[model samples]
Target: MKLLSRAFATAVAAGAAAALVSLTGTVGATAAGSGTAAAPALTQVADEAPGYAVEDFAYPDADRILAEQGIVLKRGDGHITLAACGSETGLLEVWARSKDKVCFRVSGNGGYLSLEIPSVYGVKGNAYATEVTMTVEDEEKSFDIAKNTWTPVGESADPNGRDHMLVEIRATR
Candidate 1:
């Protein structure tokens, strides 16, 4: 009986912890602050090719986390932006990007929107431009220029879908 009670309490605590985490946001990279880097730009002697031009990715269902706002992708100065669609069906949604850091990502709040009721969320957590987008929501905000492992997840259920995800940008690689 005591063990059972302990187990029940443990489950309740876990549920509460998960609730708290969801109340905040999922684990993903976030824009720290507007403040620029404190240290001076380090000089690199090696000459690397043009990095992160237009690219395509197969985002998994796990990375398909919801976007309260949408996802943004860019390479070099130019970029491409994709918004999340509300409906389950997918469609190609595209947008141009500004010049800054090539191969970078940014994500909108999810738990902030998910925590509220649908109607309340519809009013407060309202999702925009979710109907037409073919791409999935970007779940990976942690971009690595060196590893090239930072692939933001936008969802596409259609396995046979072609050109479902298209990213057009000028990269140094």
Candidate 2:
């Protein structure tokens, strides 16, 4: 049994040495400008590797939306998205003096959106509890919107009756 073990070890070592010699010959030939195909350089392989994906959370088609709807949508976590008013039921709706009603669809457990709509007076909330932030002059105010109902916001809710710009919306299930 001892002799058999020694023979097996020797055979394995011999096979490993043969493989090393074969690899070295191939690499040396390639380095010496032989016609055989060569392995890619480290830098080439690295450069060909796929790049890492990054999520900026910027709203898609934002520029087009601003141009067409006069709404400036900045960024969000993708749980909230712009939708056509009356396109579907249960959408969060905003009434702005500067434009016709704008709507947003909310999904997931919660959502957040940063946007700009001037003279926003009211919001129709969906099933989620919702809130909105508005700015009048340099003073910023927040309003909690009643779920599944219309709530006065921004200028309509302000005591001074100052026109306010809707800046943010948050919703939670």
Name the Cα RMSD for model 2. Answer: 7.9
In the order shown, the candidates' Cα RMSDs to the true structure are 28.3, 7.9
43-149, model 2: which lDDT tens digit per residue? 54464768889998899999999998889999999988999888999999999899869999999998999999999999999999999999999999999999998
* Superposed model 1: Cα runs more than 4 Å off: 26-173
Who wins the TM-score comparison?
2
Local lDDT at 22 for model 1: 65
TM-score of 1: 0.16
- Off-target runs (Cα >4 Å) in candidate 2 are 1-43, 48-50
Best by lDDT: 2
Error of 2 at 161 (Å): 0.9
